[model samples]
Target chain A: MSKVYTGASMSLDGYIAGPGESGFDHLFEWYFNGDVEVPTASDMTFKLSRASADYLTGYISQTGSLVVGRRLFDLVKGWGGRHPLDRTVVVLTHSVPEGWAPADENFVFVTEGIEAAVAKAAEIAGDQVVGVNGGTIARQCLDAGLLDEVWVDLVPVLLGSGTPFFEQLGTAPVLLDGPVSIVPGDRVTHLRYEVRK
Target chain B: MSKVYTGASMSLDGYIAGPGESGFDHLFEWYFNGDVEVPTASDMTFKLSRASADYLTGYISQTGSLVVGRRLFDLVKGWGGRHPLDRTVVVLTHSVPEGWAPADENFVFVTEGIEAAVAKAAEIAGDQVVGVNGGTIARQCLDAGLLDEVWVDLVPVLLGSGTPFFEQLGTAPVLLDGPVSIVPGDRVTHLRYEVRK
Candidate 1:
């Protein structure tokens, strides 16, 4: 059975994206600029410690598929049909975009809902892990009790206002099992929590 | 010299207090309920591990004074004149409360502003640590560049909508130092960060 998890780089103030900012420049600078020690599959160089590199590479290698929201898909312009993760990508949206033809056959579009998209991703993932991207998509999975884990790379900068990762989740409170891991990176702290049933 | 620090128990969603709730009932349950292991002074019983108890008690013992917002002060009714930390409490507000009389002589009401309240608290704190309580007070201190550290006990429950600790901080971004420490409690994860100068 594949577990569904969410991974995002968020500000200490709980924002995934800041106002008037594009390309998640500040949020992802640590990864691309070699500020933190993380393992990368590409030829890009990183300045991470050997231990951190190993841990990050290990985590990334386990992802078998990804489920993304329409907002994130549009922001990245569908990743030009291929993603660095080298896994199947499922986009959850209301309607398919016009002339949405990808050079790669791994892109999937699910219009039913988040649950259906997650189900499709999990099916494609098989025994591996299904990674959920974007805050809204993760929140939807969380509300439906479909998420197994939430990994947050808490950045040091505070973006006063922008896209908040957690919105009005209604009346009932959602509980997490444990902060199983808290790893410190260059300017970010990586926190992992298990979403309890 | 005394350093100013802000501390609060917040939801993973970054809320300090929930709607229609008072006295931080949900946030401080672990401390009052003895859910985790913690050391107690004066023979007070705690259900926390010795290490956890020591860490918590040690942190509590370091506070010489506290700066709180008017809203939080009203919610706790000024803690009935006595606070659990046994430190001087300064309430920041526009005007003094009517018929304000605390049984303890440690309570002081500062009507000028957050800066004045903090200055007064720092004077009283002297060579000890001045603890800032409540979201508004902390935010004021953060914006004014008066805070030294921020300790957050990240509770697992998500409140969706409530009193958010971090709000629109204007154009400039406030950066924090490393999460210096991340300690996992029974139902909470304690994180400590130094406010960058």
Candidate 2:
């Protein structure tokens, strides 16, 4: 069955990005910390530990589509028009941006809301997993009771203050079950938790 | 050599305690989720999973002393004159409290600062680990570059906001080494990380 899940590489203090939108070096260190190479859909390839590479192999193979917030769509310039995962991306925004030529089929813009965005992504995912990027969209899915799982690549660095991976959740103190999975990688501990409905 | 370490049962969002001093019920749910009984110095006994029991068995046996803040000292009423771990406690405060009769050997009040409190704890700890409770004291130790390790019993819950386990650290980004150990409990992930000097 296709499931709705959000994932991020977070610092020890729960931050995905450090203060002033910084700390990517520490957060993304694991992607380049090892010897094994895992090529992505785009031009980039991740060098990861044997454990992390295997973990990502399963994760990448299982994920078919992704849902993201407008902020992220603008940040990476639409991941250079295609996400690294090489799957369809549903972006939730108030309105579609002005310029986009040839209409890339992989980029989907849903102005409706979080539910609509997730539904669109799920439709594209089918039997595979719908990967949701961390931040506002993830929190929205959680608030709407649409999120099924949370994957935290728990990094060891501590960014004292920054943008949290999970925060301002309307339904707070949300109880999750089982780190259904725990993989200790080079500088990251991959932890997965199922959100209890 | 005695190691200086700090620990806490934290929510997924990095809070040691929830807003308004709440959310402890969720944070501590792991302590009683299983059948194994782990008794403490105080009347309270932790009902834990076999994994958590063994994790604590090793932790308890290795800890000889503790360092805490004045706020915690007053909050637990000095833990009824004895801490749960049954170890000597060094309280960091600006001044001694109103009255503490007969001078309980287990409770030592340090009116100096964070360094003094840790030094006193180290002196008392001798060959075992000096356990520092989470919150201000733990942050202070990190700021002073005295903390050697961090142990987080990562609970599977999210408190929107609360007192952070580590915050206000003078050093913005403190890079840590290995998780060293990762022990998965019933509802908690017993994680240990070495603080890179």
Which candidate gets the maximum DockQ versus the true structure? Answer: 2
Two-chain DockQ for model 2: 0.85
What residue pairs clash in candidate 2, if any at all?
A: none
- Please estimate how well model 1 matches the true structure, expressed as its whole-model Cα lDDT: 0.75
> How would you class the docking of model 2?
high
How far residue B20's Cα lies from its native spot in candidate 1, in Å, is: 2.5
Instruction: Give a tens-digit lDDT track for model 2, residues A29-105.
Output: 99998999999878999999999999988888899899888898898988887899889888888888878532358
lDDT per residue (tens digit) for residues B57-105 in model 1: 8687787888888887787776666665678888888788888753236
For model 2 chain A, the run of ten residues with the poorest summed lDDT: A97-106
Candidate 2 Cα misplacement greater than 4 A, ranges: A101-103, B101-103
Encode model 1's per-residue lDDT on A72-125: one tens digit a residue.
789878766666666788989888877774323678888999888988888888
lDDT of candidate 2 over B98-135, digit per residue (tens): 88742368888888788888888888999989999898
